[model samples]
Target: MYREVPSARVRGAVLWWSTSPSWTTPVRILPDGCMDLIWSQRHGLLVAGPDTTAQVGTASPGERYVGLRFPPGTGPAVFGLPAYELRDRRVPLTALWSEGRTRELDERAAYADRPERLLESVAAARLGEAGGPDPVARPLVARLDAGGEVARAAADLGLGPRQLHRRSLALFGYGPKTLARILRMQRALSLLRTGVPAADAAARTGYADQPHLSREIRALTGLPPRTLLTTTP
Candidate 1:
């Protein structure tokens, strides 16, 4: 089965797998700035982003996998906007395959060969260094990080609530409120992982109560806070 490890840096999550059973259709997860390295017996190696959700069907039986996930601020420095957008749609790495740089990834997956080598090679290509924050996204991320109320944040940005909603959708594929919620939830998860009590984590992360935190965490991660933090990656 698939297994993962939390990154030591705490800015990201990492996962490693030895073997796993076949999975069904793709599962959709929310957008975030993380990358993955997937290896399989039938498909050798693939590196992907965390902004998109992916179907697990392509993985073959008896394969080994390792994934490195980059946190939000760290993301723009790695994969460019195209890769980020591609990952946002859960598209496969091979779909965007190129000749010189990314070809080795496709070839390795097809041949079921040593994936780590390909992982190192492709990572060295430095695709993440291309883009900067979307102009519209910057203020929103800043406001959210500063613990500003959603309505106030929008107002301070000189955007009406509805205008901010539209801009967030155009820029991040989600509304501002939804993006704010995700950012809050991510902060809560980080706090909880670092030994903060559930109640305290909720308050510090701007949740009204423990149940509020639980509900949001469940909505974003498909699991409750305790399960999410305690469960091995």
Candidate 2:
């Protein structure tokens, strides 16, 4: 079983999920242009960075996991590192933070009923410590999420294409074009979950056609729409 709680405590901290499986299940996590702080009985506390491709893992039977997923470009703010540095990687939290700090966090998670809330609180505290995330990243990401092309988005932000690309690569673990594709795929999937036909969802979300949607989804997730939907929330 898995469940999530949407939170309002921090900007870009979308939601948290807890997972408990009765069997060792095959897990396929698609790239969502976001990052997650995860705690598991097996891995302790760790960071799941932005993935350019689907990540394959397994859920150990009888073990539990909790995760807090931050919106695209925000995880780096909370972690105090560039997202590019952690792209396509999962590393122990202690590698990024102090050993003592992560050890305490691991200990706390071992005892907490819902470790995600603790992770949320820690992220919130980090926001306060840094006086908040970069003011520009939010709007920049928003424009991209709305399907704006990279060149146009850069112009709108008063940035040159090269300038925008540099900042985007540093902040998002990829350039604007990749972020746009990821967000668009996510939007298309959300529409599909609402019972919109794939063709309509594709058109509504800016895909050239249904086949275009299928190709993009498969490219990013390594699964067709139906199978991917079963795996995602």
Maximum-TM-score candidate: 2
Best candidate, lDDT:
2
Clash pairs of candidate 1?
1-19, 4-15, 26-55, 44-109, 77-128, 78-128, 79-128
RMSD in angstroms between candidate 2 and the native structure over all alpha carbons: 1.5
lDDT of 1 by residue, 1-233 (tens): 65556654323335455554454323334445344555544444454544422223333444455555543433333444433354444344554445444556556545645444454444434533344434555667778766788899888888898887776654544565666776787788788888989999999988899999998877777667776666523
Local accuracy of candidate 2 as per-residue lDDT tens digits, 35-57:
88888888899899999988988
- Badly placed stretches (over 4 Å) of model 1 are 1-89, 97-131
> What is the TM-score of candidate 2?
0.94
Q: In model 1, which range of ten residues has the least summed lDDT?
A: 52-61
Worst ten in a row by lDDT for model 2:
12-21
